[model samples]
Target: MEKGTFQDVNAQVVQRCREGDNRAQYELYKLYSKAMFNVSMRITNDYAESEDVLQEAFISAFKNLHSYKAEASFGSWLKRIVINASVNAVRKRRSELVPLEDRIAGDIPDEEYDDDTEWQVEQVRRAIQRLPDGYRVVLSLYLLEGFDHAEIGEVLGISESTSKSQYSRARKKLLEIMKDTHSMA
Candidate 1:
């Protein structure tokens, strides 16, 4: 099916779900659960917790379906809920106390890496998994999830500047991890 046709069918399913159709709800879940689960996992970094978050997010989305205007795609709306649930799960697990000084740092140069080095997807994913929670969340939201720094700041409850700084630091750290792994290989 063409991308547009697929989206149209999804929109119909979403409408049916809003009207409380169980089968349509299940169809929506089938279409989106894997991607949403990945989003939850990246944020929470625990398979069990990701599963919990994913379930809660879907429930929340279904309950609040009436409020979902088509301003964004259904997947985008669902992703926002998953991200919120995952972040809340992380907060419940541990307090993320980034120092004020760290958040206030002046504009750091965006690190440039050597274009000659080839990196594997598995290596990159593992490196991302190893990042600190603050860096990982910002990086994942901005790079993988297609959120701008401003949107990330809104979702994460940080200033836009802080979001940018965290993303910059995450990129540098990811590169370092990749290089180290490459050398050891």
Candidate 2:
């Protein structure tokens, strides 16, 4: 769990974890837990449930370490596990996902820019959290996780076009919310 242990997750660490090295497994968990917690909390909106999802994700990742190839970055592989854990947690709670039909196309007006931008990072994060589940997941996967539309489609089991469309709508809605808040201020 120390910083040096996670400085690099090279082939050695992967091999060790694959061979069931407990320290390597713990190192991997500590390396990615914070990022996974943020992702899970954004999806689940419940701190305790998000913590559960984070633990579940690490357990699943460790158990399946043998299947991991070096083709994708370890962070990316772990992200898939975390996202899946969040989605599964939501499904288990039976929280109805916001329907796709609610994201119809429309012209989203542009927001005004200022040299002295006063928006805080926390405000933007809160705005993102306010987005519906469908849009929030797509937005986080694309903008935050750096997943392309096709990769996102594959992960979410949606068509590529659907991923593109969802991303566009999510951006539009997020902009709308930010602008409204700016106006209020």
Candidate 3:
């Protein structure tokens, strides 16, 4: 993710957006929509909702373009908006947020995770999509989005300990899913 480059490269484009240039808005949207849509999809696990989230995120970004202080890369800034919007969409669809299940069974050795089982991206992606919302979001944020435990905690409104435990469970669940899929295949 050449994210930092966008801060330097997209400066002119962002300025035009701030000044109400429709073409600039379009350009920004064009540049970000696919990646942002993927972010939405990972959270919502529904195509139409991801599309809706992407559109809403772009509109919000354009409307609030002035608030983008250029402290972070434009892509980073936009990604944060997309992530929040996607999470909100998921929350709305589920009547209630499923807080991460905190029960870790004993005797599940940590050494199991260290085994080198090769995994394809698509294989893991399908597995992730099948996870429950709480696990999927935590897993995606920590692994794919490069969010640390503290950042994930902040984003999901949980403590850092909760975030770490949630990620651990999510990783275990993801591996189980992959193994099941492989065995079935």
Candidate 4:
């Protein structure tokens, strides 16, 4: 199906779901659950918590379906719900206190490095998982989820500069982890 046609069908399904059609609700979940689960997992960093967050997010989305305007695609709306739910779950698990002093790292100019090394996807994933929660969350939202620094700051309740700082630190840390892994291999 053409992209536009598929999106129209999804919008229709969302309308049906808003009207309390059980089948349409199921269809919507089937279409988005995997991607939502990935978003949840990336934020929560735990399989069980991700699953719980995904379920809660879907339930919340369905309950609030009446308020959903078709201004944005259903998937984007659902992703926002999933991200909010996952972040809430993580916050409930632990208090993320950002010391004011640490919020802004020194202005590090973006740097480029070239290396003749090929890294596996799993290696990169592992490196991401190893980052501290703040760095990982900012990095994932900015890089993997296509959120700009401003959007990430809004989502995470931090300043835009903080988001940029966290992303810079996360990138530097990720590279260090990858280099260590490569040397060991």
Candidate 5:
């Protein structure tokens, strides 16, 4: 397929599935299953639970296919479903607590943006994965996913200030991780 063609395929399949076509349902599952699994795994961090989340998310997505207006990309819509499923799985496991600190430390000012872009990308992703859940969620949503504090606050159900604080802490923690690795070398 050509670049960015999957969305077209999904749109067609979704249209068919909306009309109660079973083959379209199977095609949709085949198309999205692996990507959705990764989305669930990223948040849930458990193979079995991620699988369950994927299944549940697919079921939900299929049932709600009518609500998909194709205004947003199909992948984006499917991703939202997968993310919600993963988040629900996490909530089922345990409730997350946001820290009460009202004032977060300042963010690192743009310090001659790192020269080692490749090293930084890999190391930062690893470091982010190592952060506490709250920090990880805020960092992933804000930094990686390009969500503003307000959007993140709505998605994560925390105050915008809390999201900002968590992102600040996540950055600090990532820098610490990078520093430790450099020291080790």
Candidate 6:
């Protein structure tokens, strides 16, 4: 579907939701739940925790639907909520969001290139899950979720430079994990 078409349908559903339509709310939830759950899972890295975060994010999004204002697509708006809730869940479990500030930004690696295109999606996913919380969150936000460094910084409450360096490190770690697994297999 075209982006504009979905946005049009979403606007109408959002309007109905703003009027307290339960079915419309359910429609929106059904439309977004799976993707949002993945968002939560990528950050929290725990199935049960991701489920809980998904439910909490939906409830919060519904309650705050009035504030949505259609400035962005409903999915984008809901995604921001899911990401924030997921980050919070991680923070609550870990006690803080230390941005792995040990290394200076100068240590951040440049993007690496690989000609091999044989990696399985599951392999990459497992590798991401193995990352430390700080690295995983930054990597997920910057890579999987399409948040730029500045946006990731805002969402993760770290400096933009920190987000960049953390992502570089995460990418490096992910490649190491994948390489080790391939060698073992």
In the order shown, what is each candidate's alpha-carbon RMSD? 8.0, 7.2, 8.1, 8.0, 8.0, 7.9
Per residue, candidate 3 scores C-alpha lDDT tens digits across 89-166 of 777766654432321123123232333443365567667877888888988898888999999898888999999999
Give the Cα lDDT of each candidate: 0.84, 0.77, 0.82, 0.85, 0.74, 0.85
Q: How far does residue 28 in candidate 2 sit from its true spot (Å)? A: 1.6
Clashing pairs in 2: none
* Native-referenced Cα lDDT, model 5: 0.74
Candidate 1 vs 6: which has more lDDT: 6
Clashes of 6: 0
What's the number of clashes in each of the models? 0, 0, 0, 0, 0, 0
Model 6 lDDT per residue over 24-97, tens place:
99999999999999889889887788999999999999899989887788899999999999999888877754
TM-score-better candidate, 1 vs 6: 6
Error of 4 at 19 (Å): 1.4
Please report the TM-score between candidate 1 and the true structure.
0.82
In model 3, the runs with Cα more than 4 Å from the true position are 1-9, 96-119
- Model 1, span 44-96: residue lDDT tens: 77778899999999999999999999899999899999999998887776665
Error of 4 at 140 (Å): 0.3
Task: Give candidate 5 misplaced runs (Cα > 4 Å).
Answer: 1-7, 96-122
Instruction: Give model 6's TM-score versus the native structure.
Output: 0.83
Give Cα distance to truth, residue 124, candidate 5, Å.
3.3
Q: Is candidate 1 or candidate 4 better by TM-score?
A: 4
lDDT per residue as tens, model 5, 126-176 = 555566666766776676556799987887788999989888988899889
Candidate 2 residue spans exceeding 4 A from truth: 1-9, 93-119
In candidate 4, what are the lDDT values of residues 65-153, reduced to their tens digit?
A: 98888899889999999999988876776675643234223322333435433336656876787777788889999988999999999
Candidate 2 structure lDDT: 0.77
For candidate 2, write residues 1-185 as lDDT tens digits: 86645435556777888888899787777777898898887776667888999988888888888788867778878888988888777666645554423332231334554534444665587678667777888888888878899988887789999999998999999999889887998
For candidate 2, which ten residues in a row score worst on lDDT?
100-109
